[model samples]
Target: MLELNDISYMAGNRTILQGISFNVRKGELLMVSGPSGSGKSTLLRIIGDQLSPASGSIRLNGRSILEYRPEEYRQKVSYVFQTPTLFMDTVIEDLEFPYRIRSAAPDMERIRELLPEVGLTEEILQKESRVISGGEKQRVALLRSLLIAPDILLLDEVTASLDRENARMIENTVKCLSARGMTIIWVTHDPDQLELSDRVLRIRDGKVVESIA
Candidate 1:
C-alpha cells in the first residue's frame, strides 16, 4: 500500500495542494478527478516523485519514498503526462529506450505484440516520430511508458485527446494491467473512465472533496 500523510505543495507562494492525505492499496486502480487548477496533476507528480511536496510524507509499503535513490525510485514509479514527447527519431528508437536504460536487449516479441493492442501495427515502429498524428503519437508514447510495467503507473489525462476507439484501447490495456497487479492511479475527467476505476477521488481548491470506494 502507498500511504500519503498530510501532503502539501506550493508554487510561487500559491498553494497547489493543502493538507491532502490518502492511501492506495496494492493493484488498485484509483481515479483522480477535479476541475482545472484544482491540483490533480500536482498530486500525481508528487506521488511519482517528479515534484517534492513542501510538507507531508509519502510511503510505499511501509517505507518512506525518500529512502529510495532517484534512479531506483523512477524505475518503480512511472508517470505519463498529458502531453507526450518522443525524444527519438523513429518510433522504434523511442520504444527501445527503456531496454537501453536497463542495459537489456530490446524485447522485440513483446513490443510487437503490444503495438496492435494500442491501435498500431508493426509498420508504425519504422515510422518517423515527428510525422505521426496526435492520436498515434499518444498511442506510441503510452505504449512505451508501459513496456517495463512499473509498480505504480501514474496517468494524467492520457486519453483525453483520443478518439473513442483509441481511448478504449488504452482503457482496456490499463485495466488488464491492473488486474495483473500493476497499481494504476489514473487522472481523468471522462465519466466513462471514472466508471472503470476501483475508486474515485474528487478534489477542489487543493483539497479532497469526495472519495468513492
Candidate 2:
C-alpha cells in the first residue's frame, strides 16, 4: 500500500537518511527500530509529507504522494507524534474537533466504543483534557486519529511516554487496528513492541542494515 524508493535526506553536512527503501503492504504492521539520531522519525515525516525527501519518492496506492492534495493525502495517511497535543479545554471538544473541521457530526457512539479499548471510560470525555494523565492524553490523541479512518497510520514512538499497563492497552489497540486491515508503520525502541510486528527493519547511520520478517 505504501512504497519508499531510494529515499535520502540531509541536514547541512550531516546525513539523516540515505537510500532508505521499503514497502509496507496493506494491513501489515512494519516496525522501524534504530538508535537515537538514526532518522526513523524523519523517514515517517517524509512519508506523511510533513517533510520532503531530498532525493527519491514515496508512493501510496501506485500514485506519487506529491500528486495528492495535501489535506486529502493527510486524511488518508495520518501521523501521530510521541507526545499528545490537545489544545481544547474538554475531552469531548478535542474529540469533536476533527468532525467540526470537516463539518460533520461527531460519532458519539463510535467514540464511546473506542474509549474502552484504550482504557478510558466515556465519563472521562466530560472532564477537562488538561487534568488527564499523560497516558490518557495519548490514548485520546490516538482515538482522535483513528476516528478519521486513515488507510495508513504513521506512529512515532507513541507509547514511549506511557506506563507499562497503558502501553499495553495502546499496543493491543494498534494490533486490533492492524487485524482490521489498517497499514501501520510504527517507530519504537521497546523490544516488546517488536513481538507484535509483522516485520522489523533496523537502521544504522541512516541506512537499513537488517530486515527480519
Candidate 1 per-residue C-alpha lDDT over 1-213 given as tens digits, one digit per residue, 9 for 90 to 100: 899999999999999999999999999999999999999999999999989999999998789999999877888888888888998999999999999988999999999988876778998899999999878888888788778867888999998887888788888878888888889999998987898889999989999999999
**What is candidate 1's TM-score against the reference?**
0.94
Clashing pairs in 2: none
Model 2 accuracy (lDDT, Cα): 0.92
Candidate 2 lDDT by residue in tens digits, 118-209: 77888898899999999899999999998888999989999998899889889999989998988999999998899999999998899999
Candidate 2: Cα lDDT at 92: 97
Predicted candidate 1, C-alpha RMSD: 1.4
Q: What is the C-alpha RMSD of each candidate to the true structure, in Å?
A: 1.4, 1.0
The residue pairs in collision within model 1 are none
Best by lDDT: 2
